[model samples]
Target: MTTDLVAAVDIGGTKIAGALVDGTGDLLHRVQLPTPAGESADRVMAALTEVLGGLTRHASWSRVAAVGIGSAGPVDARTGTVSPVNIPGWRDFPLVEGVRATTGELPVTLVGDGAAIAAGEHWRGAARGRSDVLCMVVSTGVGGGLITDGRLRPGPTGNAGHIGHISVDFNGDLCPCGGRGCVERIASGTNIARYALAAGWRPADPEGDTTAAGVAVAARDGHPLALEAFDRSARALAAGIAATATLIEIETVVIGGGVSQSGEVLFAPLRRALREYATLPFVRDLEVVPAQLGTDAGLVGAAAACWSDPGTFLAVGAAGN
Candidate 1:
């Protein structure tokens, strides 16, 4: 069988999604399972295995030449180990080895979710034309990766460009990652809802919706507390983006994931906050925009990150190796 596609896995705090992606960056088959993030490491691996099994059963599996995993990190690419902060059970998890065992020993490439998103966006999405860019996913946990000098630099340990973990407040709440006032502690979807609820905000549909999405609805309805929650998240996000821009000179930032879906409720304040933080002349022109790839950024980027030839990313159609 002609191997023209890859098995792509996108691992986040909330979900473990998989896809059979062809060279054209199209997902021929997709599957997903909620991450048992709070469960034991074995349980999390089971969820990941199920998602991967779904793809292996697809007819296109024969065309899958490799496996690409884009996971939440602090990942050690050198040793194929991962220590994701949000998933407490996984400390130094041998993800690549485990994946290889599940995929019939196919070649596996591991990269941080942020790096994978950056790879996908730089390949075919929002950051396509930019040499210096930051692609972020603002979901249950905030994460980011960088594109610098027209290359996807995931860093040696696959932990570079971790904007979400960057400290934004010196005397703020302690984060799950053992840091005080990290951007993810304030700007992630989980934190957004947590903060809003703590402020006595009521969700529009509190029965089954107390998430950031619920808060977004209330914010749109002009609820002060909901608005304040999103604004606070935006402020932290903006500060982190600005700090990254100031350090790396990245000109554009692509924000995606669930929180970014809140539309104007998030972007409006984010843009406004950017003005307050990104005041440096060189960083002033930094542009923050929504990701074009939407939810597929992670999967597509996983495919892109594993491409045998990096130039394959520029192909809009059937460009896999």
Candidate 2:
């Protein structure tokens, strides 16, 4: 008997990853390629094709029942399109149509990367068993998704819980997304490093690495400026999380992405700041936890989307042609 499977695709700014996932969320086969982000839209599509083609060539491809995609925002599940910020070539690109054209007859499900993360966590990660939760990824940019009443809420455009663009401080700083003092402006890895650099925190590495990872090391070693940068980021994250919890009454906030890996340097101050912001009675029990799945969360979440609703976004008959 053939084992049931789903083709999961995770499209980010840096890479486009694909995998054949089993019902139990185990990846049976995987393929990945760099996302030609600076190239034309067609070039990006070619990269996606390469990844999907590799997955279809696997021995287990015959068992694949559907395809699911977790793409960078803002994705319009209703319109089967995507407009990722980092991938400038794709502005309302026909992603679902392109996937359907490539795979021929398999149904496709589309959701923003953040929504996908939330779905993955709700199914098997830190948000497991929780009905109301918020999942965030604080890397180059801050992205988030909401799970309300035990259901993933991707919103009409698949960009529902976009906490990154939500302004935590109306007058703090102008965000590229045309918002003032957005959470991402303060808490994202890029911003963290930028703030540290501006505050006189120099990297100790001979190569002069200024990434958030470098700053994390400096913070660990008790660098005052680096620690202060993280503290500022944590405070911003706390404000954003608190606002989300207060508005939606979420019980948990699961954070992933590179910056979240800083552990105590970020979470310790985040918890303290959360206390100052989330003062509502309904939000007092909120908890913040690290994401259980690592980089594989997006892939697993994409597969979970297929397993949950095979034809939610694309027609089932559009695959395998």
Clashing pairs in 1: 23-319, 23-320, 24-318
| Model 2 quality (TM-score) | 0.94
Candidate 2 lDDT over residue span 1-321, tens digit each: 564888999999999999998877788889999999999999999999999999888888888887888999888888889999999999989998899877887778888999888878877799888899999999989999988988777787778789999998998889999889999999999999999999988998768779998999999999999999999999999999999988888999999999999899898989999999999899887899999998999998887765534224332112222
* Candidate closest to the true structure, highest TM-score: 2
Global lDDT of model 2: 0.87
Writing each residue's lDDT as its tens digit, candidate 1 over 168-243 gives: 9989999877889999999999999999999998765558579999999999999999999999999999999999
Model 1 residue 170 lDDT?
81
